[model samples]
Target: MYIHHSDVQVVFMFTERFIRYIQFEKRYSPHTVSAYQSDLDQFTGFLNNPQKLSPPPPPVITHPSQITHYHIRNWMVELMNQHIIARSINRKIATLRKYFKFLLQEGVIEINPASKINTPKIPKNLPVIVEDVKLTQMLDDNEVFGTDFKGLRDKLVIEMLFGTGMRLSELMGVKDSDINEYEGTIKVLGKRNKERIIPVNNELKLLIAEYQELKKKQDFFGNNSLTLIVTDKGANAYAKLIYLIVQKYLSYISTQNKRSPHVLRHTFATSLLNRGADLNAIKELLGHANLSATQIYTHNSVERLKSIYKQAHPKA
Candidate 1:
């Protein structure tokens, strides 16, 4: 229950170095770096250590080489008993696996206990989506737009989401140069910095093009100036703003389920699938790393079929 101060410092130093390795050497996005940092912080917190420190307690591990399967088993048991969801615990295990792999490469640990530990299996739940009538109502609810810069910006935000099926992060990261006029496509840098071109329908592109013209008339200037979506204050929109925008609009239109920005993405995927778009084609447009991730939209179609059967079948 005690680690040398020097050892703790080494761990901290290594983490900083590893973060840089992932960001620059590995070309990971800032979001990924932040997630890894958070996972490491949680893991370090669980280590029972006795150390003399000023205000905040520091980690102190005795016999670092002795980290064994029992420790990992005990951690899993603690997490399970606390009712932590299986998905979260699974992610925590992944974090540890990555960390230990790094430690092994550095010769800090003789063996990776995490490799021997089994991760909890999480059941997949059906994604919540807005129904057709409610979705129509929400998209048509332009009353959220009022006579002001903020209102115009908010309305454009929702319009872009429902119109384009862009991820909340993708919408926020958009820039002026990322849009195309002649081809009517958008260049989005998605997860892992993978770039994909999504075709923009004429209606949405014209709206965006017009919005750009209006923005230029204002003659705004800043370091983050090129961002397509922004606050009235002219800063880039955060993920929270996107969430709130969707939440407010969805509340006014739908009572079926909790409506978030992801629901818009789900709505987009399902709508496309129902309209007879190819599944693999939708996969590429959504910037999913794998087809399986995009395949969840099929469940929504199944639910739709169930609803149709319950309502129209004469067997009752």
Candidate 2:
């Protein structure tokens, strides 16, 4: 069954239903949810601190029903007084908005006071891209990678991220059976456990075949995990190891500071966009739930075009 982002977040929840709702149901990343949780906690503390809030010394509001739009406005003021940036304040406001929305859905509150709250404006930051030439040179450079299992795996990690544009989590989840070498396609499980097929080139299939052969030779540390990528000890691949592999190798060819797996993901989309691939096709390959998420690459593509124009055009 297809689970909504909110429902998926709900499934990932642990002990506290509230946070679990934020993470799995609300679909906010754990880091963002942590900040939101902190914001709510701070707001709760502020509510109890009668002096800090505008007086008649309002009574403590321990329930969502007790919250009013006025209290939220007062909290925003408090955040500004602390010299918080508009973006940070907006996030806090967002936390309350989500919180109130959840409460309203659960029938704990009749009105979402945060519903009417206006958020401060913030600047947009585009995704970072690794230049295709640099990646091409790096991958083509045999000296940079060893013929050994670890080295081949490292190269495969970079290749799959750039080649297929799958997220790091999806890469970690790849099993030996996920690749359809004959069709030259890879099926990856993306966010919320959604699966999508990304076409692989003949080169990538060969690389995977080689990696699998090496992987088979790897001793079984524990019941021989079927997970595609694995540690030296033969356990399944994990997030940190995959990150380190990307970072370590990318550092060899490019000096760009951000070399995480997601950067390769961004690079993949940017590369496709730059090469005139259809936006919708890119969206499907990346397994984005919406085209808006995939549209960010168009901005990167525009910037790259402008950069090329400046170098080639001779109006001097």
Candidate 3:
């Protein structure tokens, strides 16, 4: 890839340094680091051929200093021409901004070229939430989930997601030591390695206890596994398996176009907000970095109010 660049060595060297900085100093997750790396690769590919065709291309972008607002604008137009959504384009823009900022800090560039670029505005779509009645019926129906280990585990997985509003990664990371059975609270390791304690009600606590007992009877759990949730073979639960578990059960109860573990998370937040839970409290429980990220749930509350008003008002 460097052979295509005019100042290949400089750009190549600085890009590696930036990757290391984010991985070590910034403590970014692997998934996030991969995204940043992909963005840089895409930009470099664009620079190699602004027209995006094979060989016989224009002059390559060899150094960070060669990038300008005009180049950034052209890249945005190309992405738009390919029908990339505004949200994804905005993310790519953010990646460029961060990369250029890092270059400026390291003295690789005099001015940040991406600093002047504007992010495309994205529409706010309300999160999909499972209705309380449907969720209640599904959880209460033992005939469907059954009394077996897999059945019980699947049921608890759905309940835990809805009950705690925890992310799938957080749920997968839970350990026996993280659950304080006596205090009725579970420690959640959220994004950016931040930890928070979410209180579990008696019902959830009981379900967890039942699952634990069932786990002990099974020979699948080896001595080394400390993860709270495990597969039938006693191996650690993976993201896809958990996703399938949630998807299968939600399919039985919801007619909504989208149904996943995240919908349960949305249900948890919207349920609490509809019942008058404080926005700040929900933010803390969800382990959000800021209140703004938690504010989207308020839109659901407003829509609920509109529905109630339409039903109660007799002006028609």
Best by lDDT: 3
Write one digit per residue (lDDT tens) for candidate 2, span 1-316: 1224554343224114667776776575444556767777687667656665554333433345766787788888888888898988987887788777877887777999998888777767799777888998889888888899889888898999988888877888787788888888888776655778888988888999888877767653244688788877778787889989998988876788888999999988888888889999999998989999899788888887898889999962
- Candidate number of the best TM-score: 1
Global lDDT scores for all candidate models = 0.75, 0.78, 0.86
Candidate 1 off by > 4 Å: 2-6, 49-59, 62-69, 106-110, 221-223
In model 1, residue pairs whose N, Cα or C atoms come closer than 3 Å (at least 3 residues apart or on different chains), thus clashing, are 3-60, 3-61
84-128 per-residue lDDT for model 3 (tens digits): 999899999998898889988888899998988987899898989
Error of 2 at 109 (Å): 3.5
Better of 2 and 3 by TM-score: 3
**Clash pairs detected, candidate 2:** 6-25, 9-24, 9-25, 10-24, 10-25
Clash pairs, candidate 3, are: none
What number of clashing residue pairs does each candidate have, in the order they appear? 2, 5, 0
